[model samples]
Every structure is written in C-alpha cells, then in structure tokens.
Target: MTTFDKVVELLVDAKDCEKDSIKLESTWADLSLDSLDTVELVMNLEDEFGIQLEMNESLKTVGDVVRAIDEGLEQK
Candidate 1:
C-alpha cells in the first residue's frame, strides 16, 4: 500500500473512523481528531514508516504529513 493508504488506515484505526470518511486532504478539524488522537496517529505513523517525527516541528495538515513521508522515502 501507498503511504497515503497507510496513513488513512492508521487514522481510521486510531479514531475508529470509517475508511470512506478519511481523505488525504481532509484536515484534522474535519476529521474531528482530538489532540491525543493526533499524537497517537503520529506515533503510529512513525512506527509503521520507520521514520522519526520531530516533536518540535509543526504539522498542521494531512498534506504536510504526506510530504514528510514522501521526503523520508526519498532518503531511503
């Protein structure tokens, strides 16, 4: 599966959301993801992708996460 697909799966599992409800461009606000859920999702992503997420860095959107993963893949 693609990174975006993995992200969707992570979010859906973390939030108990339906697959159809998750979209790559969807904002956290749109997904109604709480702060704790966001943290959990980020952690899951890090674990699944084998990439470290900087806690100090700001990630405001799903697209931002996708871009980060894409960059990480390039490094691998």
Candidate 2:
C-alpha cells in the first residue's frame, strides 16, 4: 500500500472511521479526532512508517499528516 493509504488506515483504525469518510484534505477537527485519538494516531503512524514525529511537531490537519508521511517515506 502507498504511504497515503497507510496513513489513512492509521487514522481510520484509531478513529473507527470509515475509509471513505476521510480525505487527504480533511482536518483533524473535521474528522472528529479527539486529543487522545490524535496522540494514538501519531504514535501508531510513527510505528507503521518507521519515523518518529517530535512532540513539538504539531499535526493540526490531515494534510499535515500526509505531508509528514510523504517526507518520512522520502527519508527512508
């Protein structure tokens, strides 16, 4: 699967959201991801992608998460 797909899966799995319900441009708020869910999502994403996201690296939106995954994949 593509990095985007994997990222989406992480979000979907964490939030119990349907795959079709999430889009790349969908914001965290729009996705109804609570603070705890966001933290879990980030940690799961880091493990899935083998990249560590710093605590200060805020992922305020889905786009931000997608971009981070893209960059992380590039680094790998």
Candidate 3:
C-alpha cells in the first residue's frame, strides 16, 4: 500500500475507528484523536517511514499527513 494508505491504516488502528470512516479530508478532531493519540501516531509514522515529524497544528487533515510523509521521503 502507498504511504497515504498506510497512514490511514495506522490512524484507524490507533484510534480504534472504522476504516471506512477515514478520508483524506477527515480532521484529527473529527476522528477523536487527542494529543496523546497524535503523539502515538507520530511515533508509528516515524518508525514506519524513518522520518521525524514536528508535531504542529498545521497538520489538520489526513492529506496533510500524507503530504508530510511524501515530502519527508523526497528529502531522504
């Protein structure tokens, strides 16, 4: 699966949410992800992609996370 798909998968698993409910436009708040959950997700992404992510408010959507990972990959 692509990075976007993997991120979505991780989010779903991390939040214990429905897989079908996750979309590119879905917001972290909408997914019920708190600060701790976001941190956990970031750690998972870091481990999976071998990139560190600065936890910022700018990442409001799933697409944002995907783009961040893509950019991180490009830098690598």
Listed in order, each prediction's TM-score against the native is: 0.82, 0.81, 0.91
Name the lDDT of candidate 2: 0.77
Estimate the lDDT of model 1. 0.78
Q: Model 3, 1-76: lDDT tens per residue?
A: 8987899788777678788888888888888888888888988999999998878998888888899989998999
* lDDT, residue 11, model 3: 75
Candidate 3 C-alpha error for residue 27, in Å: 0.5
Give the winner by TM-score.
Answer: 3
Query: Backbone clashes in each candidate structure, one number apiece?
Result: 0, 0, 0
**Residue lDDT tens for model 2, 7-59:** 77776666788799788778777888778788888888888778877534467
State in Å the error of residue 48, model 2: 0.6
Q: Of 2 and 3, which scores higher on TM-score?
A: 3
User: For residues 16-43, could you state the per-residue lDDT of candidate 1 as single tens digits?
Assistant: 7778977767777888887777788888
| TM-score of candidate 2 versus the correct structure, residues matched by position | 0.81
Error of 2 at 58 (Å): 4.2
Taken over the whole model, the C-alpha lDDT of each candidate is 0.78, 0.77, 0.86
Evaluate model 1: give its TM-score.
0.82
Worst 10 residues of 2 by lDDT: 53-62
Tell me the spans in candidate 3 whose CA falls farther than 4 Å from its real position. Answer: none
